[model samples]
Structures are given as structure tokens and as C-alpha cells.
Target: MASRVTMIAHLFGAMATILMLVWLLHYRGGIDLDSDSNSDRIFNVHPFLMFFGFIFIAGEAIMGYRTVAAERKVQKLFHMVMHLIAITLGIIGIYAVFKYHDEIGLSDMYSLHSWIGLGTFCLFGLQWLFGFFSFWLPKSSLATRETMKPWHIFGGRALLYMAICSALTGLMEKATIMGLKRGNESRLINFTGLFILLFGLAVDLSLSLAY
Candidate 1:
């Protein structure tokens, strides 16, 4: 059951990435880091990285234990590495948005989307640190790891939902700003949001079934 759900999650992840690319390349202009329209291009990086690099990779990390038939240590190492990569990309994604705002001379973190997105990113960082110290390192006792396990899992699940909320809100905010109203772009945005939501759902379901 868990394996099946994990596969579904992976499918959703791929769908989300394709939709995001379509939205950015077809709807918005193609990405350009050094062009005169760098602001818009840089802003495009935020959604791409956040969705594919951060959320999708993080989901895969969560499903690693259930999906991969590897040794415990191997699974743990892969999970941690995936999360670390996700965090690194998440940082770049956040920076991209901030750089876009700076280029446009707009204030940052003024919208609810930014507020939730930034807050979730901070919490994710803290969660990663706690997991690293509590489980990955041998400095902590087995009892300590057992005590922290539930909290870690719960926090991760909560953070995943928070990320999904951030993504959905960000998409809506962008659509409104771009004046998308009943068009192909708007439909693509809606489908992208649905895939994201489905990905989160599949991850959560897989985790629940695994345990």
C-alpha cells in the first residue's frame, strides 16, 4: 500500500514539475537570469525551485524508508542527503524572490504568501537541525532518538502541509498579480496547484500507511 502511494506521489511530483515549466515558459516568458527582464525571470526561479527542488525532493525523503528496500543506515543517509539538497535549493528559491523584489524596488514579505513561505522555511531549517543532531549523529542516545522520533515525524508532516499551503497561496497571489482570469495560463496554474496538493496527499498517506 505504502509503495503504491509512494509511486503515485512520484508521479504527481513529475506532473507538478511539467506544469510549472509550462507555466513559466509558455505563460510567463522563458527564464533569463542576465536579461533586461531579469526580475521576472528570477521570480520564475522561486516557483520552479520551491516546487521541484524543495517540496518534491522533501516528499521523496519522507517516503525513502517505505519505498526503498535498502538497509536502515542507507535509508537514513539517503533521506538526510535528500533533505539537505532540498534545503539548499529552498534557500536559493527564497533568495530568488527577494532578488526579484529588490530589482523591482518592491518591499519584501508584505504579503501573506511571503509570510507563510518564510515562516515554513525557517521551521524546516530548525527541524532539519533537530533531526540531524537527534538521529543522524551518534552523540544522542537511543532513548533520546526514540523520544524525538514522534515529534520529528509530526513536525515534518506539519511542515509539508505548510509548504503546500505556501505554494498554493503563492500561485494564487501570482495569478492575481498577473491578471490571469479564465485563460490557459490560469488553467495551468490551477492544474499545477492540484498536482502539488495531490503530491502532498500521497506523501502523507504513504507515511501513515508505512507506520
Candidate 2:
């Protein structure tokens, strides 16, 4: 059952990735890192990186225990490494948004989506730092690590959901503010949001069953 659900999760995740990429690259004219000259192009980078870069990667990290058939040490290492990648990409994604705002002469953080995104990102960084210092840097005593494990897992799960919140809200903000075309375009965005939500739920469920 666990494996079956995990497979389902993987399927949904891949579909979400494909949909997001198609929307961004095909519909949104692809992502641009070098040129802030095109505000629209830079804006496209924001969603792709935030969802696939941060949230999707973080979801993978959360499922490492269940998905990776490896020793405990290997699983832990893989989890941490995946999260580090997520954080790095998350930083770039956030920067892309600020850059987009600047390029368009738009005042930043004036929306609920931005507010939630910033807050979730700050908390995510703190969570990662705590995990690093406690589990790795100057490794805590066995008892201490055992005591912290549950909290660490809980925090990771909560933060992932918070990230999903940020993504969903950002999607709404984008769709409404941009006044995306009434028919197919809006439907595509809505389906993307649905898949993202499903991906997050499957990750959470996988973690719960595994750990």
C-alpha cells in the first residue's frame, strides 16, 4: 500500500512538473535569467522556480525515507542535500520576483501572496538551519537527537504545506491580476494548482506512513 501510494505520488508529481513547464515555457514564453529587460519573461521564472525548484524539491526531500531504499545515514544525507538544493533555488526564485517588480516599476510586497511567500521562506530557512546545527554541525547527543526528531519532522511537514499555501495564493494572484484569458488559459492554471496541491498531500502522506 505504501509503495502503491508512493507511485501515485510520483505520477502526480511528474504530471504537475510537465504542466507547469508547458505553461511557463509554451504559454509564458519560457524563463529568462539574464534579461530583466522583459519583465514578463522574468516573471515567468518566479513561478517555475518557486513551484518546481522549492516546493517540488522539498517534497522529494520529505519523501526520501520512503522513496529511497538506502541506509539511514544515506537517507538522511540525501534528504539534507535535496533540501539544500531547494533552498538555493528558492533564493533565486525570490530574487527573480523582486527583480521582476523592479523592472516593471511595481512596488513590492503589496500583495497577500508576497506576504505569505516571504514569511514561509524565512521560516523554511530557519527550519533548515536548526536541522543542520542539531543533526550535523556539532552532532547532538543521541538522546537529544531522538528528542528533536519528531519536532524536526513535524516542522518539515508544516513548512511544506505553508509553501503550498504560498504557491496556491500566488497562482490566484497571478491569474486574477493578470486577467488570464477566460477559457483554456485559466483552466490550465487551475489544473496546475490542483496538481500542486495533490503533490503536496501525497508527499505528506508518504512521510507519515514511512516515518
Candidate 3:
């Protein structure tokens, strides 16, 4: 039962992420197939997905961790933090893009946002590398443990902080997209995610006792 529930959560999280990525890559973020939109409007869809997607993904990671062994729990927690950070950086990038809307070049905000995003991606890359090489490591090597453990933990937390800032940036981007207007749409989206995350956490807590 626990496995089934966990699998369902994973599936939902993955589906949400794929939808978000597709929406962002095509219409928002990067410069491709030039469109008739200003800097303020550029990140509409990207931030939209980012705000909501991060919430869901974060929740999945947290709930999923409950099912793992104590030893593996740390690794799972690190993965959660890494992803949370990546989402955050993306959020911040959305804001930075808007802040430098009139600059028309590499602005300071853009530079900082880009670097933070790059770092987040790098850490995520390392996480994937560690996962891929997990079986090949020698038992006697301290290097593998150190890299996989402490480095990942620190990287993950840094990533989380970045992600929160990114989310704030995304919110700003959304407001700009609507011409300094505020609406319930973005709020609703975020609230939906919050609800899902909270509900998932509740379910996991309940089931933990049974398991």
C-alpha cells in the first residue's frame, strides 16, 4: 500500500514537471522564435509553472523521504533540497529578467540570477552523477561518501534558499506581465500547490504510523 501510494505521488510529480518544462521552454525564458512581447511579459508562463511546480515537487520529495530507510533518508532529503533550489533559481531568473527589461543587455540582476541558476544546475548535475555512479564506488573510499553526503547537503540548502528567492522573483515577473496588475490567478495557482503539498504531507504522516 505504501509503495503504491508513493508511486502515485511520484507519477503525479513527474507529470506536473513535464507539463511545466514544456510550457516554459517553448514560450517563456529563452530567446527562440522571437515573439511580440516585452521583457515584463516574457516570463509569464515560465513563472506560472515554476511557482506551482516547485510546490508540488517539493512536497513529493518530502513525503517520499518518509518511506526510505534512515541511511537513505539523508540522500533523499538532499535530492529534495537540490530540486527545491533549482526551482528557486528559475523563479529568481524570472524576476531578474523583468528587472533588466529596459536595459536590453546583460544587466547586473541578470548576471547574478544567471550565476545562481547555473550553480543550481551544476549541483543537480552532480546529484545525478552520484546516483548514476552509486553502484560502482569502492567500499573503502571516503571520497565518495564525503562528496555524496556533506557536499550534497550543503549544496541542497543553498539551493533551497535560492529557490525561495526565485519564487519571489517569479511573482514579480507575473505582476509585470499583467502590466503592474494583481489578480487571483497566480494566487490561486500557488494556493492549489500549497494545498496539494499540505495534503500530501498529511497523508504521508498518517500512513507512516501504519507502516
Candidate 4:
């Protein structure tokens, strides 16, 4: 059951990435970090990286243990590596948005999307740190680790959903800002959001089944 669900999650992840790329490149005009329209180009990086790099990879990290047949330590290592990569990309995504804002001389963290995004990112970072220190390097006592396990799992799952919320609101906010009507672009954006939501749901389901 877990394996089947994991496969479904992978399919959703792939579909989400394809839809995001099509929307960004075909509908929104391809991204460029050093373009004349710095604000728009840089803003493009925000969604691409957040969805493809951060959320997708984070989902995989969460499923690493259940999906992979490996030693416990190996699974843990893969999980941490995936999350670290996601965090690195997430940092770049956040930077891209702030850079875009700077270029446009606009204040930051003024929207609901921004508020939830920033909160999720900070909490994710703290969760990653706690997981690393508590479970990996200089490992805690077995009793201590066991005590912290449930909170760690709950926190991770909560943050994953928080990220999906951020992505959905961000998509709507961008669509509104761009005045997207009932067209291919708008429809693509809607589908992308749907796939992202599905991807999150599938990952959570897989984890629950494994447990």
C-alpha cells in the first residue's frame, strides 16, 4: 500500500513540475535572472524554485524512509541530504522574491502569502536543525530521541501543509496581479495548484500507511 501510494506521489510531483514549467515558460515568458525586467524575471524564479526545488524535494525527504528499502542510517542520510538541498533552493527562492521587491521598491511581507511563507520557512529551518542534532550527529540518548520523535513527525507534517498553503495562495496572488483570465495560463496555474495539493496529500497518506 505504501509503495503504491509513493508511486502516486511521484506521479503527482512530476505532473506538478511539468505544469509549473509550462505556465512559467510558455505562458509567463521564460525566466531570466539578469534581464531588463528584473522584477518580473526575478519574481518568476520565486514560484519555480519554491515548487520544484523546495516543496517537491521536501516531500521526497519526508517519504525517504518509507519508500526506500535501506538501512536506517542510510535512509536517514538520504532524508537529511534531500532536505538540505531543499533548504538551499528555498533560500534562493526567498532571495529571488526579496530581490524582485527591492527592484520594484516595494515593502516585503505585506501579503498573507508572504506571512505564511516566511513563517513556514523559519519553522522548517528550526525543525531541520532539531532533527539533525537530535537524530544524526552526536546523537541523543535513545530515550531522549524516542521522546522527541512524535513532535518531530508532527512538526514536519504541519510544515509540509503550511508550505502547500503558501504555494496555493502565492499562485492566486500572482494570477490576480497578472490579471489572468479564463485562459490557458489561468487554467494551467489552477492545475498546477491542484497537483501540488495532491502531491502533499499523497505524501502524507504514504507516511500514515507506513506508520
Model 1 stretches astray by more than 4 angstroms: none
Tens digit of per-residue lDDT, candidate 1, span 1-211:
7778888999998999999999999877876655474478878989999999899999999999557788899999989999999999999888888888888999998899999999999999999999998898899888888888999999999999999999999999999998889978899999999999999999999989977
lDDT of all predictions: 0.91, 0.87, 0.49, 0.92
lDDT of 2 by residue, 1-211 (tens): 7777788788887888888888888788888976745678888889999998999888888787556899878988888899999999999999998988888799999898899999999999999999989997656898999999899999998998999999999999989987887787788889999999999999888887877
Which scores greater on lDDT, model 3 or model 4?
4
Better of 1 and 3 by TM-score: 1
Query: Top TM-score: which candidate number?
Result: 1
Q: Following a full C-alpha superposition, what root-mean-square deviation does model 1 have from the true structure?
A: 1.0
lDDT of 4 at 75: 95
> Backbone collision count in every prediction?
0, 0, 4, 0
Model 2: how large is the Cα RMSD against the reference?
1.4
Give each model a TM-score.
0.97, 0.95, 0.43, 0.96
Ranking by lDDT: 4, 1, 2, 3
Q: Where is the poorest 10-residue window by lDDT in model 1? A: 30-39
Error at 76, model 2, angstroms? 0.8
Clashes of 3: 4
Which residue pairs overlap in candidate 2's backbone?
none
